[model samples]
Target: MHSTVILIEFGAIILGLGLLGRFAGRLGLSPIPLYLLAGLAFGEGGLLPLGASEEFVAIGAEIGVILLLLMLGLEYTAADLVGNLKAQYPAGLVDMALNALPGAAMALLLGWGPVAAVVLAGVTWISSSGVIAKVLADLGRLGNRETPVILSILVMEDLAMAVYLPILTALLAGTGWVAGGLTLAVALSVAGLVLFAAVRYGRVISRFVSSDDPEKLLLVVLGLTLLVAGIAQQLQVSAAVGAFLVGIALSGEVAEGAHTLLSPLRDLFAAVFFVFFGLHTDPASIPPVLLPALALAVLTAGTKVATGYWAARRARVSARGRWRAGGALVARGEFSIVIAGLAVTAGIEPALGPLATAYVLILVIAGPLTARWTEPLARRLAERRRARTPGDPAHGRPAAEEATEPAPVPD
Candidate 1:
């Protein structure tokens, strides 16, 4: 009877997710926010809370996080990471300064302590890579010149996580400085070793993992990722990071094959991960934090836009591209929840999880809209300014149009 109930409940959840995804698709929106809402509806203090399938969902959520990171790693080679890190380090620093400080300040203002402040800082700091990638692809902006600048910022953030997560893990565990320091050192060493190996032996690793048979390839890759992730978790280095390194280690045909085969699995598990986050968060807890979350969301949204604008401007992208870049960077999805979930699991401030939830929901939905409209809005505003100051000849023409104009065909 218990097994039967679990099956029924789990089946219902999956079916509901399919409907939500389809609904989101028709609206030309990312399905993440919908998945999260569904989780809330079925969570504690919700319309129809689940009991039998909770454990299964929890396990699936963990796998989701690992697969998410693994797929992200597959998108870039070691050389790409290094090149971006070198060329874009300054922009990355600017991004951190602009985006991270607001969350830390908000946490401090709330008296959540330094640790919670650090966690909140991270929650706000990183943008949703998965959502942004999809948006760029969907909008046909992948070929845009400003896209590389956007991608560089994201790569730097992901690389920073290899360092950040271990420290966060140690802190959440209430480890001493010595222990934390040791954990960070181990994490850095492992990351370095993985990168080194990837650069030097990536092709060899790919050949080893490569198989002609799709089923065999999928099983080998998935099993290897899980094994590495578990071992990394055991070492306090983080399972996601371990899986990411495994993705980096495999290159060429193996990485491409693995990505193709595992994408559906990643999507399924990632949805479960988002749902698991919402499942643990009490819907009742949201209202109290909603106001503060909204305020934070507004402030951080502006900051993210600023961060992207500055990065793109530095890259010498045109005005429209800069606005688009800024707007594209506004969404906070999986990483925000992942960071908050850690703190929630550690029983940090009860309100933190709710606040993060509200914050992410607002931004995730707004992100796509902003990406689509920010440039046009900026242009309209500029036109109004020019109309107000007709004498200002520079503002007479659209900045994008002026930037794109061919150097008046030399006579």
Candidate 2:
């Protein structure tokens, strides 16, 4: 595309995203659904004929995730990473494994080849934390006990899947690398990444990056994001992985504030990244993969709700908390599609893209709706439990007392 055309396209993208953001806010819905609706409207399906390519839009979506995950990583510490493993490992190991199983079986039933089924199944195992986290924060559940457990699982699963995605795609594409002790290489690389993050970038960014200056801080963040991503590419892992580590390392208070310095930048990139996703799909030629995409959406989202509920129950949370967990796990946003795109770039197959997109879209819509109403849903179940247990503490307590209670003292 010519520079003029590129500039014009970018300008239109900005305008469309701005409008959709406003519209979504008014409707009390996530802007993602609206952005996608706009994409369909302006894409081949509509009269505008913007000629957006799923491949290109999707690629931008992946970059957006890398940036977002980089932010997420900024929130972690070494013990937290280990704590994530302990808190999240079993649930994630089980949830993702079971989730993929059904998806693979369904794909095989649909007569898809094993490779396609595997790729599709892997894609389905993904859940959208972006949408989930947003809704949790919106509903004031971010610091809740149940929320942290769900988030821990999400973090572990995302980290694992990020690495697994490229490997699986390479495997399916017959790319000769995994065979040569690639797992060992990955493990070592991750260790090296953690070390580098701590020793090289962790302690000194405040001083070395001249973070006292606003412009300098932004440059520091942007530079580190790209730098780590580039290094990940050379290591055959993922730049997003490195970026996430950056986030984790930096999650500490670099300065005294309610929100970190990265807040505006995070919001800006996140909007661009997701809006870019919205701009990617062409409704006129809704790819044939949309059907299978919807199928995987049902498969994955349904499985997540069920599994998350079960996990929350095992953790001995209230029925309402289980429902919250279910709602939280319903969406598959940036992380899901990023993994899918990685598969394609690794030469897995073309069909996977549409399938992942369809599922991701479904998850985005379903996740927030579930989260938005989860409190009411939780209350209903709590009421039911109180009814059955006659004299349940929930009912026995005065409303004012309950309001002052600190979440039932968390057992």
Candidate 3:
């Protein structure tokens, strides 16, 4: 009875957040930003100050990211990866590097300690795939040229933990250098092989699991998801990465509607995670640090903007179109919090968790404000492009799609 009550108490907090997100979505606001705001409001930082336990909230947040990655794996195909790369192969790499490198350098310079610097670098490199994908879908731009670039970058971001997190975890566990390095290499290799094998033979293997028994298939998927996750834990890998691979493996292969099986569980707990992160952060500490947090936010936000433009310019995109793409890429959500949270877990530094949390809070607020502003900028650019090219309503079509006239012989 006591256990049930405790579960209900924690459950209600997250349930309420989802309800709030739905209401916000109805008002033309994005659910993720509102989700973060609700977290802030019901959090220690916000008015309510829930005093929620960090461990509890972390579970929810972890599941939220887990579900997101799984769903992405299901939707993504190697062809999709190839297409995404073709559109903007180097964009994500550039953005993450530019963002992470400078951040690490600054952290080192600040006398903040190596752990904090490395954590900042990792978090800065991540872009919110959940946020970006949702926003792009909402605006009906998911299939456009802009989208391929976005997707390519997002996929790279998802794979980052495979490379960085395992080593971090091993070090924190006090494993010897040789063992930690070996574990890291093994984790990457395992994940790569599994994913590569799945992609290469997905179409063939998926056929066997194609059945009408949604419940049964879902159970099978759960077994696989947890098993892979356990393997990752044994390897000192991030569970989120394991869950992602599981989801990727299960994607499109299980029964048609089987994806629905995990939705309720994902939702119920993801709320708890948001509230936990909010609770872990002490609002009183925020005042003295507000200025630096704000300054850092501005620097990162500006860098993302520049990153989008640089990618666009490399692709020979127009000045206005570049700005629109840049604008669209500005929103960052789960990646920052997840990486920061992992840093604390990895024991890379002390008081580092709180610092990372503070920085994420800043990004949460800043991301939406930038995204909101970009909406109008994109519209204006489209209008100008259309108006300037009166003869071609669709602007420019590729040579393959156009009807070519036969060339005249010598005059």
Candidate 4:
């Protein structure tokens, strides 16, 4: 009876998710926010909370995070990561400064302590790479000149996670400085070794993982990623980072094949991950934090746009492209939840999770809208300014011409 109930509940959840995804698709929106809302609806203090399938969903959520990072790693080669790190370090620094500070400040103002502040800082710092990638592709902006600038900032953020997660893990565990330092050192060493191996033996690794049979290829890649992720977790380095490194180690055909085969699984589990996050968060906890979350969202959205704009301008992209780049980087999805989930698990401030949830929900829903409209809005504002300027002929007559001729009739 218990098994039957679990099956029924899990099946219902999956069916609901499929419907939500389809609904989001029709609206030309990313489905992340919908998935999150579905989770809330089925979570504690929700409309229809689940009991039997919670454990299963938890396990699936962990796999989702690992697969998400793995797929992200597959999108870039070691050389590309290295190049972006070098060329875009300044922008990365600027991104951190602009986006991270506001969250930290908010946490401090709330008296959540330095640790929660750090976690909140991270929650706000990183943009949703998955959502942004989809938006760019959907809008046919993948080839836009500022896209590289946007990508570079994201790459740097992901690479930064290799170090950041370990520190966060140590902090959450209440480890001493010595222990934390050791963990950090180990993480750095592993990350460096993986990068070195990827750069030197990526093709060889790919050759080893490559198989003509799709089923075999999928099993091997997925199994290897899970094994590495488990080991990294055991070592306090982070499962996601380990899986990411494994993805980086494989190059050429194997990476592409793995990506193609694993995308559906990634999507399925990623949805589960988001749901699991919401499942644990009490919907009742959100209202109290909603205003703060909204304020933080508004502040961070502007900062993200500024980060993108500065980065794009640094790359010599046009003004419109700069706006696009800024707007594109405004979403905070999986990673924000992942970070908050850690703190929530560690028994941090109870309100932190709710605040993060509210914050992410607002931004994730708003991200696509901003990405689609920011550039055009900026253009319109610019045009209006130009029209009021007598020297700009595009919107109005030149200063000299305006003085020499009667004012044009209103359109």
What is the TM-score of each predicted model, taking all chains together?
0.96, 0.81, 0.81, 0.95
103-217: candidate 2 lDDT, tens digit per residue: 6776677676677677667667767666777777777776665776787777877677555655664565575664535743774577466646664566565345445666667
Candidate 1 residues 1-411, lDDT tens each? 999999999899888888989999999999998888888999988899999999999999999999999998898887787888888899999888888899999999999999999999999999999999998888778878778889999878887888889998888989999999999999888778877888898888888899999999999999989998998888777788888888888888888899999999999999999999999889999999999899999998999899889988888888878888999999999889999999999997899999999999999999998888887799788888887996897756755564542221111
For candidate 3, report its TM-score.
0.81
lDDT of 4 at 373: 86
Best by the lDDT measure: 4
lDDT for each candidate structure: 0.89, 0.65, 0.65, 0.90
lDDT of 3 by residue, 239-340 (tens): 778877665555464624546776666655555565555565555555656666566667877788788777867766555445546766766667677766
TM-score, structure 1 vs. true: 0.96
RMSD (Å) per prediction: 3.2, 4.6, 7.0, 5.2
lDDT comparing candidate 2 with the true structure: 0.65
Best by TM-score: 1
The clash count for each model shown is: 0, 12, 2, 0
Q: Per-residue lDDT tens digits of candidate 4, residues 336-399?
A: 9999999999998999999999999999999999998887788677767988876765666333
What ranking emerges by TM-score with the best candidate at the front? Answer: 1, 4, 2, 3
Model 2 lDDT at residue 213: 63
